[model samples]
Target: MDDINAWVWWLVGAAGLGIPLVVTAMPEFGMLSVGAVAAAVAAGLGGGVVLQVLVFVIVSVALIAVVRPVAARHRTQLPELATGIEALKGKQAIVLERVDGSGAGRVKLGGEIWSARSLDGTQAYEVGQEVDVVDIDGATAIVM
Candidate 1:
């Protein structure tokens, strides 16, 4: 019986260490249940309970300490907008329609038609004129 108890405690400690690691590696299933189950097993085994608890605590803390900073740094590095209109900045476009002082015209940018405005507000741009995109206001491009 002593041998069986020792084996059981060893298995419990191994599982206490392994469960958190698996949780850290594959967190899509949610780590709470795995942690709770590991904790319950550690508590029920009784023998080497302190060692098992320490192992679990150490593994959990190590995982958090290592992964949290990487996650934070990655979050900071990602662009705020992933797609759509924000992707059109700095592209060269051609004037498809004359832009008058009223800020009304059409531009062909990225092979797509867009309502356009001039930043200088000077002479109106004629059709077939090439323009540089400065900013986007809704569906309109402020051009130069």
Candidate 2:
């Protein structure tokens, strides 16, 4: 309505922008919401409509240009965390029983007993010997 202040309209616009940001999980909407807030500040300071619009556009464009690439770069980078079987590979295990290529044996790996076999068919690991895990085959660990 004509009676409503321009700053109040800008606040409403910001809230409207916030809805899509929440629902879609898009950062651009959030940047636009911040721009709306900047426009609201301009309105509160008695700036003309063109000045308020200019403030909104400049703030929105700046945020999008700067934040989007940084966010994309972070998203594309891989985390340095390894879990489950992946964490077991290349780890040291103590042979609980004689480990050989011909039969299954037990090894204490990461504080747990795991079925193990030798990586090389002719090689064998004696009890209390330390071995390096090479790979995981189902429930068994291949060690050397």
Candidate 3:
């Protein structure tokens, strides 16, 4: 034990924590590894075991208690974005073919052809008419 240095032990601890970080993909382990490195620096500078341990504990706990919540908050937040077919809903389309609710019709939506149907089953749209997209049923668009 006397042949090896205390800083070496601290470095080994950091490496041990790093293993879990890579294997489990847990950011907490990476935080702890940083603390271990800080402790190793203290040990290399002749810090007492108590001081080194205090540095490690304070750093690790502080990172977990403070940074974790902020990181989690940012991670869970999503930008205000409408994606996929939902983006097409409520948009206007030009009827390329006569649209009858009970009949297959085509519309030019977002510069592409899309199958369209009337919102009301009895309603119909004429060719070249512009209508609002109401909903989507798979590949079909419901327009009003």
Top-scoring candidate (lDDT): 2
lDDT order of candidates, top first: 2, 3, 1
User: Residue-wise lDDT of candidate 3 within 44-132, one digit each (tens)?
Assistant: 99999999999999999999999899989999998578899988989999999999897499999999999989989999999999999
Question: Which 10-residue span in candidate 1 carries the lowest summed lDDT?
Answer: 27-36
Q: lDDT value for candidate 1?
A: 0.69
Q: Give the alpha carbon lDDT tens digit for every residue of 1-144 in model 1.
A: 554544355455556656665867644222333443455566566636575566556555665667667777986896877466667887788998997555689999888899998888886788999888888888889888
Q: Which regions of candidate 2 fall more than 4 Å away from where they truly are?
A: 81-86, 98-104, 115-126, 134-144
| Cα shift from native, residue 108, model 3 (Å) | 2.4
Better of 1 and 3 by TM-score: 3
Per-model TM-score, in order, reads 0.65, 0.75, 0.73
Clashing pairs in model 3, backbone N/Cα/C closer than 3 A: none
